[model samples]
Target: MKAHNSKKVIQYSYLFHKIGILDDEQYKQIEEYHGLKEKKKY
Candidate 1:
């Protein structure tokens, strides 16, 4: 179960990064919907 969860996290993280959807504006929109800000690297 733990491994499965980790895999899912990694998969989604890769998908997000590949799509270039990690900018400040998109992050804010995601935060507004999900109720928390994501830690950004750039």
Candidate 2:
């Protein structure tokens, strides 16, 4: 269970970091364009 949770954390972190590659303004624009406040949770 511990290992599984750690893997999830790593996955989430990597995903967010990948998204972070976009410029902040672009990201914000995307969120607003999509009417989202944050990334959707699975």
Candidate 3:
């Protein structure tokens, strides 16, 4: 996946999680699938 797209997905997922729209498990799945969570400065 492109880094740009992955970054957006991560950002949006975090927003959803923060707003109570997504649970921890779902947020973890999205983060893992996106593979950008490993980058500390992404």
Tens-digit lDDT track of model 2 for 21-40: 66556555544544332233
Candidate 3 per-residue C-alpha lDDT over 1-42 given as tens digits, one digit per residue, 9 for 90 to 100 = 477788799899999999999999999999998874446435
TM-score of each: 0.47, 0.47, 0.77
Scored against the true structure, residue 14 in model 2 reaches a CA lDDT of 52
> Which ranges in model 1 have alpha carbons more than 4 Å from their true place?
23-42
| Candidate 3 wrongly placed segments (more than 4 Å) | 36-42
Best by lDDT: 3
> How does residue 7 of candidate 1 score in lDDT?
48
Error of 3 at 40 (Å): 16
Each model's C-alpha lDDT? 0.50, 0.51, 0.85
State which candidate has the highest TM-score.
3
Q: What tens-digit string does per-residue lDDT give for candidate 1 at 4-40?
A: 5544655565567568857656644544433322222
